[model samples]
Target: MTDVLRASKFSEWKEDFNWDTCLTGREKYGNFLVSILTSETNGHVINLNGAWGTGKTELLKRLYVSIAKKQHPVIYINAWESDFINDPLSVICAEFLNQLGYLLANSRPKKELVDINEALNKLMGSISKVAYIFKLSSLGYKAVTGDATLNEEFDFSQTLLDLTTQQNSSSMSLENYNKSIISSMLGNQIDLVEGMKEIRIQITSISHILCDIYGCNSPIIILVDELDRCRPDYAIKTLEVIKHFFDVDGCNFLIASDTESLQESIKCIYGQGFDSERYLRRFFNQKIALKKPSLYNYLLKKGIDFDGMCPNMTLTPYSNDNERKIKLLSEMLNNDKFELRDIERFIQKLTACIGYISKFNVKNAKFINFCVLAYGIYEHEKNVNIFKERTNKMSSHGIHCNGYISNGMSVSNFITIHFKMVTLANSSKRYNLDGGWGSCSYQTEMLTVESQDLQTRDWRREDLIECERLIQNYRNAPNSFLLWEDYQKLIGLTDAIE
Candidate 1:
């Protein structure tokens, strides 16, 4: 199965509010929200706002399960998934009826359940008929005015004339007569008004029945998720349908969305100058924003074992300590901001690179570290020249090996020193002039000075010594050294894996 399907299955089994695997500490917040939802007896609408990939959907699913476990009538609706349907009311009403049926299955006597189901079905049938009439009238108007393109030509004018002739025997002009027929067909909106009132009353009765069955005074909780991910018209229509048809005395709505994106969607439908925030204020009683998870904790929860042993240990002669690898990588990434999705993509790419490198048995810690830094820079800047420029800057600055040294060096500084040391050591060569060989060696002098500097800065001595050893090893086996071009090749090879 795909990861999405697997996760969906897992979410079904893991619905309790006190989940052991919730690393972001959201379970406590879920409990708190559930308490507030259950204590309220009147109709309410609460908007849960968070950025994309901030676990809004997961939280909503958990909330659905939590409320269900408490014997409260609750329903979960994914608005984006159902946005393809033209009417949001039908989608919502269908889900509501289905969930209510499931909740009432064994709670009531069979005859009572059948009677309640029959009543609900009858009310829904009436509502559907009224809704269908309104839809036909709307489509008729659109067809007549060329607002909606149809496959065949429509004789709406003639149709109106025929209706007018059939209804009246008095003499009347065709234009005024046609307007009268059209107005009576389309502009007499009281049918929908009366239909909605009936729907609200029926829903209020159903919700009260649910309250008695569930033994709770709270309103039925309806969760609408991913509203911002839907089409502009669908999202707006969902809010309107809920406010008009489902806003009864015993219903509560908790809409989970990225409100900023939802606001933009509203602007798309109602022009750029629309006051979307003020308009949204009419639908929601309060808005709650979810807290974003920390990067380290999120990574850990996503199954990144930073402290575990390095894989393919036999492929390389380096120590099998993965903690150092994680430390260096965390230092490199800690200052940057990444959404949860971006971090997941980064981890996927990193895993692919490590897997490809393992095939070549090139598991040197420094090499892996460079791969991490290169991919990070590429992701952020979208240009390899930034990597080259940093290295070039380090070269021009004379490799300041003795200027300052510390265990807590910034990633930028560490990257410069690390790459420069490798380049200087690997570039050492001998030139033959007039049949005599002369050695041009600056690496030895730089290493000597760096060693002396490390003696004074003993706190980071081990880290600096490890860097010197890597440089020396690369100098001894220059073929194993990875230049910028080699790093690019590695990246290219792994890019297709994801």
Candidate 2:
């Protein structure tokens, strides 16, 4: 492999999404979503549902770019990235104003732009007050304002004396003094409902301005990604902010997340019996589930060269047919329910094992299969005892067992039996040969085996006989046998590479 390909193989894969680079054929779905979002005049909330690592972020990015190409105003917010902030409304409002400024950068008539800016300022002010109210309710008045007096127990005589002192100095009335105290604690004197009403009017004006700048059919599309990865409070609050505040005409929302995970988040906030599904149903107009890409297509896009990983392996199961290797690997991944992120890690570790094998110039078919099986088991179980237990099953049952029967007996079963036989033989020495003749003494050196409790079942007579036969067959060709120590070394080598 070239240096570029080697670096690309182990590095994190970031999709640079465009219509031409959409390998999973999801651009068609993107176009369909665009049609739905643009066809409506009123606001619509779309829940784009997909499990983690199913490419939700890429789909949302593609949709954002596609909508932008049609001269529509769009904003993409990563909710996971912004969940550190206490208020999701603040994050959304900041992004909205930034994107809106960009959209109105070169618009005609400076007076209309000024009017839009004024309306946006009012809108932000209204949102700030609402967010402040939420903070006061959750964090307490003293925590928000840092005013110790607000938290102190009220004293009627002391309070009256303080008010009288202020009244004497500034000629302030008792009513005004009470209003000042309320304003100081609340951060604003406006009623929350009145403030919300003002926000709605300002949003209406801004939405009208956006329609005038673009077209009557154009609406501000806000795409929120990774909502499921956020904290439960942050995730639920984001949904509430979008539904209650931004549910105006000419404003649409496309939130991409695992709806099931988000539902669990809702349950976390409202308790187990809250009917989270019904709550989500009230926010979204439609829920569209994204289909996961096929394993073949995903690997092709990833550009994995299995042939290059182990070249010149005439004796291997997949030497002549790389497609068969891919098929078997795909079956293993699907059986384990490997997500895209898990698949990437598996490939990285497998490549590291192959790299270690290449140092010894041992790229045969059996060794290649051993590397694949070893890493697959490692990725799935991450326990040596589990690996030995599975291998032991292959020894006693001849690979025809329930879990070992997949991908046919030739490829899967043969590899398991081969792995077990080699490791068992190499695990310990058969004898300590020593002889004495007259005054001279002779001692044969024995290989020192590392103590490992592999948790294998008791060996049967047939298993020992097979182990002895295989050990003697490969006595002169030790390189053909991969020991348990060698497997451990291979796994250790992968840690550094990863």
Candidate 3:
């Protein structure tokens, strides 16, 4: 099998259709993100909510590139990544400095910014040592800032005051800074609280300094992605970091995650009896959800690159038959409520399992797509017997189960499963004889007396037993992820049996 070559999508923005197509119903959603990120507002939290695998990260990536084109300072944190850190404050301070470091370098701010960088390095090291800079790193900071053995060894109250006093030619500014810095520190006798307060102030001061350096007109846009995937403790800590530390003048936070996932995480942290949604609402100023794209538009957007295909390409241009297959796939997606990632995953797995399938023969591709997705949704992928049996019932009952309530609501015994067929021989009354039978809507079907012939077909007990044959055959394949017997059977029970 030959592999299909793919192109780099980094420059895909150059193709105006990506944003203009409205295929995903996100044209305005993307536009709104760009507006908020580039807007003059400061200290605002804007949310982009979408289900897992529904393109939240994709949307943010596009927005990051677009807004940064205007020289806006933006910080992107994959919260899922930093969740491993023991200290939430440490993660917050680290990301803030990491991204700001790039902005400072990229903006080429005046020479005074040099002093700020030095101050920040010292401030960051101190915050890490005080909070959770792992054991080994903590030892280094303990030596640099103060001894690890004593309380008075590290004067948390004097960190900023001493740093500011060094620039005493500007004595008035130093006095005001010292008062604000030490007053809060001395008032809070708790050592941890004092360290946290200092960290928050340091972030705010840097934000203000950046705004001044970048001409004070640009609001820094911080994109926090994948918070929904973090552990509840990690996720909540991330939110607190944003609320307390990044909430300052000249800062706008655009966080991309689903409200439901975050709510669940909150519930996990607090008791199940807690009102998680209400608690989560305190963090964001506005939330915008990306609506699920319609079947036609969704398929259209996913299939656009298939126009010019090669053996080594990830996509294949549809022929008359492939287009028909796509229509059926689209209906399956609609019926099953498959999110963007699910659909893409189904395709990727389908391609790898059965490489280089012609547009004329996607029957097996469509068949495996549904089965694999069904097993995935149900978390039954590890059990082939259960998966196969469940697939049969799923197709027979005109039902679609996504395994869990949060992923999607399962559709059971529909009036008409639009993408499915109605079989004549058995209980699969809502099934068709051909896998591609349901895709044609704009055309007319020929009425014939030959339908009476299907009524007389013979029944066999072996037909049911052959299901075992299928299970074993799939297991024998070099790549078991894609089952290639094809969806010829997907037409319905009798279709496969006959």
Q: Candidate 3 lDDT, tens digit per residue, 378-414?
A: 2222233433443322233224432222123223311
If scored against the real structure, what TM-score would every candidate get? Answer: 0.69, 0.65, 0.57
lDDT of 1 by residue, 364-476 (tens): 43344442334443443344445444431124532111122235554555555455443432224432211233345553422221222222243354554556565565556
Q: Which residues of candidate 3, in runs, are more than 4 Å off?
A: 1-25, 110-205, 304-325, 349-396, 399-498
Question: Alpha carbon lDDT of residue 434, candidate 3?
Answer: 24
Candidate 2 per-residue lDDT over residues 1-498, each given as its tens digit: 111121111112223656777767777788999998877658899999988778888787777667766656677888998788787766676556544534443233324443444443434433343333333333343353353432233221222133224224332233454444335544554554455454455455556655653342367788999999999999988998888778777788899998998899889878999899998899899999887666656666666666576564322334545555555555545532456666767777776666557655652323444433444444434444544443312234232222222333434443454455444433232341111112213332222111122222433334334444444544655566555455555565565543
lDDT of 1 at 468: 51
The predicted structure with the larger TM-score, 2 or 3, is: 2
Identify the superior model by TM-score, candidate 1 or candidate 2.
Answer: 1
On TM-score, who's better, 1 or 3? Answer: 1
Top model by TM-score, which number?
Answer: 1
RMSD of 2: 13.9
Every model: Cα RMSD to truth: 11.4, 13.9, 12.8
Error of 1 at 411 (Å): 3.6
